[model samples]
Target: MKNFKEKFKLKLAENNYKFTRQREIIVETILENENWHFNAEDLFAAVKEKDSEIGMATIYRTLELLEKLDLIHILDFNDDSRVYELYLKDHHHHHLICKGCGKLVEFSDQGIDYFEKELEDKYDFSIDEHKLRFYGYCGDCRDK
Candidate 1:
C-alpha cells in the first residue's frame, strides 16, 4: 500500500497535480479493497465510512484522475454501472460475467496469445491490450 501511495505521489507530481487529503482517502479506500471491483457510488459509500466530509464529486474526480494515471481500470459489463479495479501488470486478467446474477469472476489464460496473433496477422493490426468477457451462468447459478 505504501508503494502504491508513493507511485501515486510520483504520478501526481508528473501530472502537475497536488495530492490532496480527499484524494488520499479515495486512493486508500481503493487500495483497501484491491480485490473488489466497485463503481463510484460503491466507492463513495466505503470512503464515506472512513471520511464523512468527503463529497461524491471528489470521488468521481479522483476516479478520473486515477484512471488517467493508469493506476486503475474502468470496466463496463454492458450495465449502467461501471466498475473499477487496480491496474497491476502482474494481475492482468479478464472477466467472466454471470448473466444470472451479475457476478463477475476473474480469469487468466495464455490461450489468448494465439488468438491475438491470428487477429494481428489477419487484419495487419498491432494490438497493445485486449479486454475479453464471456457471459454465462456461474456454477452457483447454473444449478438454479
Candidate 2:
C-alpha cells in the first residue's frame, strides 16, 4: 500500500493533478481489491461504504482520469456496462466472463504469448497488449 501510495502520488504529480483525500480514498479502495473489476456504480458504492462524502460524479471523473493516466484499463464484456482494472506492469492476463450471472474469472496462459508473437510475425504489426474474453454460463448457471 505504501508503494502504491507513492506511485499514485507520483502519477498524479506527473499529470499535474492534485492528490486529495477523496482521490486517495478512491485509489485505496481499488488497491484494497487488486483483482476485482469495478464499474462506476459499484466503485461508488464501495467508496461510499468507506466514506459517504464521495459522489458518483467524482468516482466517474476519477476513473476517467485514471484511465487517461494509464494507471487503469476499461473492459467491456459485450455487455453495456464498463468495468475497470488496474494496470500492473507485466501482469497481463485474460478473462472468462459468465454471460448469465455476469461473473468473471481471470486466467493466464503462456501459449498466448507465443500466439501474439506469431500474430506479430504473420501480420507484421507489433502487439502491445491484448485482452481476450470467453463468454459462457458459469457452473451454477449452467446447472440451473
Best by TM-score: 2
Q: What is the C-alpha local distance difference test score of each model? A: 0.89, 0.87
The superposed Cα distance between candidate 2 and the true structure at residue 8, in angstroms, equals 1.8
Tens-place lDDT per residue, model 1, 73-116, is 88988888888888887776889999998888898888887889
How would you encode candidate 2's per-residue C-alpha lDDT over 1-144 as one tens digit per residue? 577678878989988999999999999998887575878887888899999999998999999988898888889776789988887776788999998899888998999989999999999999876778899999999999
lDDT over C-alpha atoms for residue 71 of model 2? 83
lDDT score, candidate 1: 0.89
* Candidate 2 worst ten-residue window by lDDT: 31-40
Give the Cα error of residue 10 in candidate 2, in Å.
0.8
Model 1 ranges with Cα > 4 A deviation = 118-124
Q: Which candidate has the top score in lDDT?
A: 1
